[model samples]
Target: MTNLKLHIDYPHDIPIDAFQWTPETTLEPFHTHTSLEIGCCISGSGVFYFEQKCYTVRPGDIFIVNQTELHIAQSDEVDPSTFIFINFDPSILLLEDEKLLLPYSYQSEKFQNHIPAETSLACQLQPRIMTIHEELSQQDVGYLSRARSILIDISVLLLRNYIGSISSEQWRRMNHSYRELRQMLEFVHRHFGSNIQLADVAQTVGWSQARTSRLFREYTGKSLRDYLAQLRLSEVKKRLVTTDDLIANICFDCGFQSMASFYRAFHANTGTSPKEYREMNGLSEDFEKLGDANEKSK
Candidate 1:
């Protein structure tokens, strides 16, 4: 019998979401508020598409995606693909005094530029990912705290592994690129819901618009514009699930220019219209509240 795995936990306040998917299903293209992602394959095999490169993954395999990289997952064979995804805000690793103790320090250098398929780091990370998955599966309080600790441990392991591999000069070069990328990412996160232009983003990162476009595409496998659009749509979905804002208001709030554009993009990305998507997802109450709020404000 083929065993496929798909599990999701919608925890409140953390802005992180976890889910599992198997060969029988495919997940839509999605981005997250969390800048770092760690996933492990427990059984079967699959492929992960990131910034146009396809990484073949299997049991006992793991991959780390830097923040805001456009990615999708798919199963490779009839065997069910079982894996666990751990997502978290990058700020969790940026505590003032502890900032230097992170993998992010190795930025554009060999460590950041190359993604080793099966490293000693992978061996260290597997247990941490597994432990977190177990804790999340539990129906206990403080699960969020437990998850956070595991994530921090994983980050430390990555930093240590990276430091062992390169010279200070290499580290310095990579760190420079890493810093620029981090800044670029911060700008996107902060202003995704505004009238952001590609040239503006380039200027913010101190790179020419063409160079910035190439680097972003190289790192994330999607154009800057498309990535921002995905981020906006993701924010809109989160609001739809958690707030009572009108669809039109949510659309504008998410930086969409008009209801028509929002509808087209939403449907193209999510396979459903905003109104119908909300209704189908048992958000009828939210739909009604949005209508009521609009009428009241008039």
Candidate 2:
């Protein structure tokens, strides 16, 4: 299956990020991130658009998204879904187990992306995940260490229950494939802000244009152009929220060839114009902070 190439530059200070939210009434655009994400449905029902299929999600249902796996979430608007998400770098788990879970996680056939409530493991995992959420929210002095411990326990459980060991050759193949994928993703990140094309990416990775395009689509589940558009949109979104740049300027700065295309693409991908998005996020006050600080300096 083609996976979406999602890049998340996580903050160094905190290697893991966790949160719970009731998705506001809309279908999230196709997206991916660098952190491996574990999600549990807290209430209501929803569907996760993943791996070119839809997986129904209900209360207590658990889903896993590997780093750079393209996916989207849509709640049943009438019922609405609340879900808790825990996103962490695999390296963070190695603090306890130096080897990490890489070996087990690579066992493709045994590893699963979704676990329904009917499963025995899911029954056991729901409560533990909730407890971890509680520990994080309360932040009772040693909560950070406590939270990490719980996370490690969860990782171990998943490895034991769902993953299987691979043979030497299989392990070597999977490792090499994933390393190449990461390099391709890094190339996309480095050049997305410029006039990067599929041909350019293919040449950079030492492949024919046709071969590169096909592989990119197969692995990412989206076209190279579409991924580039999403990447540009993300940058535009960031600039909209954090800076006072003009909309047209932000569009060009992020690599859109013209304002007409930018507006069309932004609205199609985000469901809102750039002006409306800024207002919806309520970041104008955040943008004003710089001016306020400057005035105080005077």
What TM-score fits each model?
Answer: 0.55, 0.52
User: How many pairs of residues collide in each model?
Assistant: 4, 6
Report the C-alpha displacement of residue 291, candidate 2, in angstroms. Answer: 7.0
Residue lDDT tens for model 2, 173-258: 76565555556767887777789887778777678888777766644445789767867887888788777789988988789998
- Note the Cα lDDT for every prediction shown: 0.66, 0.71
Q: Which numbered prediction scores highest in TM-score against the true structure?
A: 1
What global local distance difference test value does model 1 have? Answer: 0.66
State the displacement of the C-alpha of residue 276, model 2, in Å, after optimal TM-score superposition. Answer: 3.2
Those runs of model 1 whose alpha carbons end farther than 4 Å from true positions after fitting are 1-124, 131-153, 280-298
Return the top candidate by lDDT. Answer: 2
Candidate 2's TM-score reads 0.52
